[model samples]
Target: MTLGEKICRLRKARGLSQGDLADTLGVSRQSVSKWETDSSVPDLDKLVALSRRFGVTLDELVCGEGDAEKEHEPEPLPAAQPQGRQVLGGVLLAVGLLGLLLFTLLWGLEGLLLGLMFLLPFLLCGVLCLKVRRRLGLWCAWAVYLPQQVYWTMATGITWRLVLTTPHFTREMNYFRLFIGWVMLAALVALTVATARSFSGLRKEPTPKMVGVTAVLWAAALLIWRLRALFFGLFADETGLIQLPGLVTGLLQGACAAGQTAALAAAITLTLALLRGRQKQTPG
Candidate 1:
């Protein structure tokens, strides 16, 4: 079939008169008739518009020989932006690895340098995750840092006091591990809430009081955990390096302690984000 014949067939199948299709496209009915009669072709822009309006690919609409399999198939979106994000993520990860090597060489046998090596990548990944808007970028950032979180959660949570107090523990007394885990958990919760709101198409404004209360809870809990650890450190054996458990065990323990706070804060923050997203979706 010719392009003209295909257009006529599709238009009739959609139950649209030439005048109706032309009206939908903001063009003259005579132009539609002319195209159906093989008088002239639509401009490129018009062709795209027609393709969209008729739910057909540009190929299917412009040429009668469009494949049946390709007719309703949506074209794959361009990956230019995602490719750039991946490159950036790769560079950041490499820098982190380089930092680790340097730290290891400079501070041999003193796990402090190795600790810094572990931290740099997580910090970099967190920054990139927050800065990049694309899902691919966010996930890439997470992938780089996720292992660290798992390691910390397993190390610290299984025996919170061990990772928090030991000289061989993360140099920051488990603080870095806690902080990174919380950040990642928060992002996950926010993403979840945003997705839920998008699908439901509902918006709800979170009160400032709610945010303030959550902050207060977070601060108070953090302060108390730190103080408790300090007092415990004073009484415990100070010389030996405690063997901390793996990532799974540690995170479970951490979740039992301060992990809940981070998770809760994440849920609240995500809910607020979802509310805002839904509001934007609404017509002004």
Candidate 2:
């Protein structure tokens, strides 16, 4: 089908007449009729508005449904993902990888955790830059880093004693670290899912349902985290437990969970995207 046919079909599917669409798009009824007859195309902004108003993706709105599969662009990388952000992400990835490599070569095995602690920001920023279309690299960078800092602090809780005149171990910080660790973990997971969804060729708008769903997911993640003691106690021994503090263990758990969630979300995203591609190829 031509673009005009697709637009007319979509407009009718949404129960809109030429005048209705024209009014919605701030154009004359004649202009809408011209677009429907393929005399002329809507401008870019109108095209975007039409897609939004019809609740269809721009890809579906613009691309002919009956076109040959291979005729479509491969990857959609250049158009979907901007070049400058990809380059910036690549640079950050290089910096992070080289930084970790240099640290490892100089300090050998002892500095691995230290390397992770310090290098997470750049590495995360790089990954987010490459993955997300939005410029959320900085927010994504901090969401994980701030919690890691708390992790690092508790890992060296020896500092708490070192700074104080009278050194004493306390449970005060345990709750704080555990709760805040999960908060950041939930935020990171939500961001990971959002980032995965971006590959669907549509933007996600925030809604009350979204907020409520997020809150529920956060609760689930927190519940899983709350049982970390039992989970760790089963597999971990005293010698091993002594070496890595509870806060550090919590952070590691969060990291592993985040990685797994990212992988799963990405897998689902790839599957949906492939399905959409197949739909676009299939003739109606």
Candidate 3:
């Protein structure tokens, strides 16, 4: 292959457009285009930069003597082995459907509602088992988990008034539920990290900017969660005391859960970016 062909192939392999490559090389897209078309050649300094960017030696880049064409040939991707995950996904889907049917028959509308709430996560889990790329499935699954209390109240025909006024809604029960919420939050973070690492491309170190963004997102989320009491104060009664209605609190709590999930997602993204950056810096 000619030098221009080599540059073209290398740029494509890195998933860069002429504009992107130009930005990195501190040159115009036209320059890169000209280089790729052999209408012009990069100077020695630019050549060195190109070699470094593509992780190729100067000799190999210029002389095309390193079996460059053969080395850069696209390899066939292995076929997916879907038997195990597909079977697991199918089983979970069946269980969710079965539960929906059973509950609808036994408890009528209320049971159906409850079953549907429960079914969402199981169905998503099944999708996750089938296709790892469906990260939104995991998010949907977790979203259902976040509003469990709201769903419980609705299913049991319990009013917000009863929850607030009744003595049975003890502080201890609230604490227990808070603890569970934290546990779920931790699980979400862990799952997000695991999912990011599972993808081969995300296993590299991240850039400093990415790390900063992650830190900022986490800090913002924590700040918001900590200021929940202040926010509740906004909905206070005439006495200037915080007095949240049950449904409002439930909605706020669900929003908090979603925010926490988003923060964890940002953290996962930073982790992957950091890994990619580290890999780039490391010697092969």
Candidate 4:
């Protein structure tokens, strides 16, 4: 291939637009366009910058030598085969049916309601994992699932308040709860790291937009958590209704949980999109 073709290929392989490449190279977009069209070649200094940016040697970039095609082609994404899809569908269907049966047998209406509440996030995670089709997807699935499960468990009466206040609670049970909480927290941290690594591999850098969004989200979550009682009291008094604090607290908790879940999900999706975009750039 000509130098222009090689530059074009490398630029596309990195999932960068001409403007993006130009910005990185500290050149005008027209200069990049000229280079790709063979209208003008990069100066020696610009060539060095290009080589470094694309992780190629100066020899490879200037001489049009080496595995330029292979290096420029992105890794292929793993596609879900027909058999795999069928098996996955069957498993999901069976699990849903079994869950329904169990709910019917156990607590009837209340069980069904609780089961739906608990299952929604898991179902969403499963769908996202299938759509992402990457190791990062599995990590994100757990990230979404763990917090939702913890919230549901706590909502079912194993709250921190109860654990802290109840003297009759068994020491063993408290330890068990603490262990579970720690495990969930550790899993979340691990998943976050894994997701960041995967994103870096695909995009070669962490996205400032996503980092900013995540920070905003977590800040909001922490703020909400800290001022939860204040919000509850405000809403309770505004309604002029008795026994409304519990309702307000529940609503606020759900909203905060939802905000937190959305933040994590958005971060995960952004990373997955980066990987997917790189994979899609691979030649068929």
Q: Each prediction's Cα lDDT score?
A: 0.57, 0.61, 0.65, 0.60
Q: Identify the runs in model 1 with alpha carbons over 4 angstroms from their true place.
A: 1-78, 109-261, 270-284
* Candidate No. with top lDDT: 3
Q: TM-score of every model? A: 0.32, 0.42, 0.46, 0.50
Q: How should the candidates be ordered by TM-score, best one leading? A: 4, 3, 2, 1
Per-residue lDDT of model 4, residues 1-284, tens digit only = 77888788888886678977875664558888999999998988789989998878888877877775667466453233534644664565456557766886799876775565555555554455444333535554664655564454436423222334445656766666655545555555566666555444333123576557646765664565556556555655446543454533454575555455445645564555545545645687
Off by over 4 Å in 2: 1-81, 142-150, 153-219, 235-284
Give the Cα-based TM-score of candidate 2 against the true structure. 0.42
Which residue ranges in model 3 land beyond 4 Å of their true spot? 1-80, 101-113, 133-216, 226-234, 239-248, 268-284
Tell me the tens digit of each residue's lDDT in model 3 across 1-284: 78899899899876578976775665668889999999998999889999988878899899976665654665343124356668878998899889999999999976886686668667767777776533445554554554453454333422222333334556855645444445554565566665565443433234466577777887865676567657877888899765765545655655564565566566666666566657666898
Candidate 1 clashing pairs, residues 3+ apart or interchain: 153-250, 153-251, 154-246, 154-247, 154-250, 154-251, 157-250, 157-254, 158-250
Question: Relative to the unseen true structure, what is the C-alpha lDDT of residue 193 in candidate 4, on a scale of 0 to 100?
Answer: 66
Off by over 4 Å in 4: 1-86, 97-109, 136-140, 150-153, 156-173, 202-215, 235-258, 261-284
TM-score, candidate 4, is: 0.50
Per-residue lDDT of model 2, residues 1-284, tens digit only: 88888788777765567876765665568888998899999989889998888766678778743333423334454465567778988998898899899889989864665676777778888888877654375456554545464444446432111223323425665555455545555655566566555455522223465445545554544454346456666766666553466555656565544433443444454445445545655698
- Best TM-score among the predictions, by candidate number: 4
